[model samples]
Target: MAGIAILLDLWRKNQSFNAGLYSARTYQSTQFFSASAAATAATFAAGSSFASRALFGSQVAYSDAGAALPEDYISNIQSASERVFKNHALQYSTKQYDVQLKPLFSAFELRTFALTSLRSFLMYYLPLLEPRVNMEDDDDSLEDNQEDRHVDLVVPFKKSVIQIIRESTVVTTRRILERIAVHYVSQRMAWKILKDVPQSAARKAGRQMPTLVYIYCVSRTTFRGHMLGVAASWIVQVGIDLYRFFTSGFKTLQEDDDEKQVGVLAQRVSVAAVRCISSLIFASIGAGIGATLIRPSRGQWIGCAVGDLAGPVIVAVIADKYFHVTL
Candidate 1:
């Protein structure tokens, strides 16, 4: 019943978001037409002697005002075009920054890294992560210490099974939620970028319905290079992590903090490197699997997207079980 209710709620939210998007598009169309009409009128009045005189007292007065007719018309169009282009360029830059960050998509990215890095080294091994919120430090500590979160059973075997199921469900749901949010925000950012004026970061990044990314990865080849790229990226990230693990300065953990918080340049670089590498590997794997199942290009794209998202979590889990070392 709970799952059904959540599904129904998500469906409703999706419909609402689609409707809002349609309305926004309609509004922008209206604005564009109006602006076009106004520009046309201004240009006509400025260039034609009769229109200029009729509109602004007299041709003599217009010329006295020092407004060159052709220059004004040309400059107006140029300015409008430049404004539109500049706004779009800014949004493009933001998107590029986002791609560099990888699995740390939006707000959850950093916290995800921190949790994965911290928990991997702890003596008491907890594989699942709790969601971060803006609560007090003491509240966070209390929550962290409660190891039986989401699953509690007396028998070790039964408890482990239940825990794994519960954790997997939670992890999967969170990933979906984050992906949905990122997808929508990205669409909104695209629209915001194309405007004559710049949009606020909050306006572009805030709550929105899930929408497709207007842009996508360019996978032009069916060669095995995609998979090779994935492996290469992972290897590079592992190398960087090892380098950072050895060179980065030690930072003391906060009194209430559950994990060691390192603040060295090497650590930051390694985290970013690892994220990018994982993203590439997953994308390649996804593309290959998808191609086998469907159209090569479409399948590749779908696979790549899924891989990019799931890759980080997979890496984190592998590290937790095998490496069992802290950064």
Candidate 2:
């Protein structure tokens, strides 16, 4: 009975302790709800006020880059418009842009004009002053006979001589032009190109691109184009020499009837062949010397002419002395 009484007393104490803890927790929760409600009410009151409304409305005000032009932009546009108006006024106004020019003629000019007018007048009128010549009964016959003689005697010789002259003239002109191009282009430019063109291909592709271009212009070598042109010119000279020799020799043979005397045709062909080669060599030497001493194109032409004239004499002399042949 005494142990049961002590147990009952301990149970009552535990129950009383639990009730006090529950009351304390409920009081804390009530205080927290009151404080939160007061804070919420204060926030609502502030939000409804004029200053808060103004602040909130001002936060996201209307704006864009196109809404207003910059001060500098407006000023620049105004300035440009003024400049255009000023330029236009200056350009079109008679007071600003009026210009006049009058030609002044000298005494010499007037005399020249008068002389030209007189000459033109004379040319236009003077031809009608002459009376027409009367035709004879045998005039047609005489004209026909003259035409026939011209066709037979003059035409063939003239045609042959003219053809030879034309060929020589064309060849000579081509050579002169080639020499001039070489002197102007190669000597003036090729050496500089050689210096600038780099040996390394990698660098050529990079910094020295113009050097590569120059090297290409050089025919992939040192003034190779000029050398090739000279060689081509020499070959052309040989062909020209052959034509001149054959044509002149044939004409001479026909005039003198010397074919029978010269014996073998082979010897004549050999002599002519040797003559052309020897002449070309002599011409090259002479051109080199003349070019070194004088203006390149003029010197080349002069030297070529001298060598050309002397070449035949040299051949003739050689034939007379060494070969005992008159070629």
Candidate 3:
């Protein structure tokens, strides 16, 4: 019985040992599987993150590549190009006017010549009508009395006329030239501003609208239609001068002079008429040249019209106030 009991104890011990071993093996397997699963999950997460980063990088690159050019930059480049073109056009136009138009217009030299001739005629003829002073007046008392009397001597009309012509021509020419120079500079500036605006904006504004905008911009600035105004003023002045000179000469011939010689008054009137007419014609020519050369936008035209109308008046005011010119 003791031996059997000892054998039973041994068997129980073996079975207990085996059961503990099986439990430990199952636990180890579970642990191994859990570790593997965790590792796989971690790897997947890492891969996902890497993929996300790569995608983000690609997206950023695409966006950068697709970015549009700056509008202002484009506008600047286009404006620069247009300015270059306009400058060349202006240069060519100037050359054409100087070489071609000036020569053709020279036939109108009569316009100025008539004025000068009339002045010369009046200066030579009018003095005859003045009362002659007797060098033989004998009495000392009478001489002394006459010397004290301020004689209202009539100016020979011819001499007066000539003087008027010379003065008017000088004054008118100076004003016309100044106007031309100012207009040219102003137009150039306006063109630069107009060209500098973006092509996209211009296109969006459409044909008539853009032109109007350009005109408006130029007019508001010092550059609007200034050239045309300058030119027109010159033309008008010249035309009026020529008309007066010729008309005065014809009228002088028709006048009845009681002395049978051209009176001082008649001569003076002729000279004055000639001078006035010549100045007017020269002014007109200058204006015509400006109009031919300056091609402003429609808006510019409106601005030019306003400037043209105002230019002479302003010049006159300046001359009267500062230069002491007879307006």
| TM of each candidate vs. truth | 0.24, 0.27, 0.22
Per-residue lDDT tens digits for candidate 1, residues 1-327, read 223323433553465555556654444443344344334444444555664455555323433342334555556655666676677788788433232212423223557545643443341234334454535568767777575355532344455554444333344443444455455656554333222111121122233412221112122131222433344444444555555545532333344332333334456656656776677666655655664455545555566678877977888788778998332
Candidate with better lDDT, 2 vs 3: 2
Write down the TM-score for model 3.
0.22
Between prediction 1 and prediction 3, which has the larger lDDT? 1
* TM-score between model 2 and native: 0.27
Candidate lDDT values, in order: 0.46, 0.46, 0.44
Question: Which regions in candidate 1 have their CA more than 4 angstroms from the true location?
Answer: 1-263
Candidate with the greatest TM-score versus the true structure: 2
Q: How close to the true structure is residue 255 of candidate 1, measured as C-alpha lDDT?
A: 46
lDDT of 3 at 265: 38
lDDT of 2 by residue, 123-238 (tens): 43454455544455598877875674442434544555544444444445444544454456645343433232122222333443453363343223323223433344455555
When superposed on Cα atoms, how far off is each prediction in RMSD? 25.7, 31.2, 28.1
- Number of colliding residue pairs in each model: 3, 0, 32
Q: Write the per-residue lDDT of candidate 3 for residues 1-327, one digit (tens) a residue.
A: 223323433553465555556654443443333333333333333444445536555433332332333456445555665676676688787421221112222322676656755665666655555565566666996777678565443545545665556545544554454444545655554343223222322332355444445434333332322333334434555556556656666666755543333354355445444444333333333333333234333333333344444545655676679988644
Poorest 10 consecutive residues by lDDT, candidate 1: 209-218
In model 2, which regions exceed 4 Å deviation? 1-263
C-alpha-based local distance difference test score of model 1:
0.46
